[model samples]
Target: LLTPGLRGSKAPAGQNENLQGLKEKLCLMGDANSKNYRPACSLCPVNWKWFGGDTCFYFSEKEATWQESEDDCFSHNASLLMLKRKSKLISISQISQKRSYWIGLSYGVDGWSWIDDTKLSTKRMDWIDLSSKQNCAYLFYRKSRVYSENCYEKYPWICEKAAVQLI
Candidate 1:
């Protein structure tokens, strides 16, 4: 099967299909850190300097409301709560144990979308269920790492400043 945005002149016959199958297989195994989660400092794909915790501080910027937090991330050309890998999720849980922080999740456009405008579409990816939604944004606590929150709530947050690299 040919996947959209995967066709190229150099691609071998059936190569894209095989690749897609492999990707689906991996996704079915849950995230990388499903069994045990941990926290650590690392660079995020969207360019935010991540410090494993419940909240990541941006230089001198202090905490703010969920909307304000989202705006702050946007000012830096980044978004809050975009996890590129499972280890990052573990780190987030290890970083802080408090009220849930706001993420880039929103209920505007289609049913829901990321702050970066990416549509929420994933069959293998798992999300933390909080109040009454399956596709809402995610927040991390020192003890747990998946929970939903109202986008208008005030909470300390972490935002991705830029993309260091794209995979």
Candidate 2:
């Protein structure tokens, strides 16, 4: 078995390709100059995959209602996504694929709503889909717009927790 610090210190042949692909994708994503750099998920309790950013996101295949998903995320000290601008939304879309995930912002009794203490304002809000508002929000690949999906239908999710911004 080849140990991590091998004699030659070279990665397996195919592994380099995967790394390159990920790099290319990230390069295409461009810089993080927008105001939508929100936390996708945080890994303080159980260790999950590291998503490069300070935050961590999860893709749950297990089906559950929207409220149930929110409860699950809150239990872990994270909340759904609440994008601040179009650029941020696009950045998130790139990270997430076809699998849908719940975000913090949604349409409630008042029309457009967000989790308590969301920093976004109505003027800076951008809805993936203005027409679709079933009950909860779901993000999908190639979706120029967002969809309102049932909470019970499980999909991938992105969580967010505040980080101390460096001055």
Candidate 3:
């Protein structure tokens, strides 16, 4: 049967020496205890802003209209933050205190929906005023609830994107 170092015939003398050198180099690199060895996910990209739960979140300090915020997120290859899980609210609240940040929800012809066109359910939202005339939704940190605001009004925003997988 064919095997390494015995492919059809024995490797030439010089070829064997080259293979041995390569093997030693690979062994050194593969050592787990080596100081140079680091996990693939040890460092996230500087632009990711914040990383959690396989997702990256960015909180903007500058204020912008809801549409402008959406555009900004798109430019970064992300979208306006859409909290699908209730648990994420706590994380968001801790990051933003006494400030309102634009999310993805907005009232349109089909009622409230995320910028990605996903419909929002009343059961999943904590709205402060359901009857507000505003069309865009923002989170109020103090109450840890959502409130409708004029879409034209400028406000800080949050963006979200899927975390990069480490190879």
lDDT by candidate, in order shown? 0.54, 0.58, 0.73
Clashing residue pairs in all predictions, respectively, total 5, 10, 0
Sort every candidate by TM-score, greatest first.
3, 2, 1
Tens-place lDDT digits, model 2, residues 25-80: 43334346768643222223353334455555555556566777788778877787
User: By the lDDT metric, which is better: model 1 or model 2?
Assistant: 2
The best candidate by lDDT is 3
Better lDDT candidate (1, 3):
3
Give the Å error, residue 158, model 3: 0.3
Minimum summed lDDT over a 10-residue window in model 1 is located at 38-47
On a 0 to 100 scale, what is the lDDT of residue 89 in model 1?
64
Error in Å for residue 58 of model 1 = 3.6
Clashing pairs in 2: 39-160, 40-159, 41-56, 41-159, 64-152, 65-151, 65-152, 66-151, 81-104, 128-146
**lDDT of candidate 3 at residue 70, scale 0 to 100:** 95
- In order of appearance, the predictions have TM-scores of 0.52, 0.56, 0.70
Off by over 4 Å in 3: 1-44, 127-129
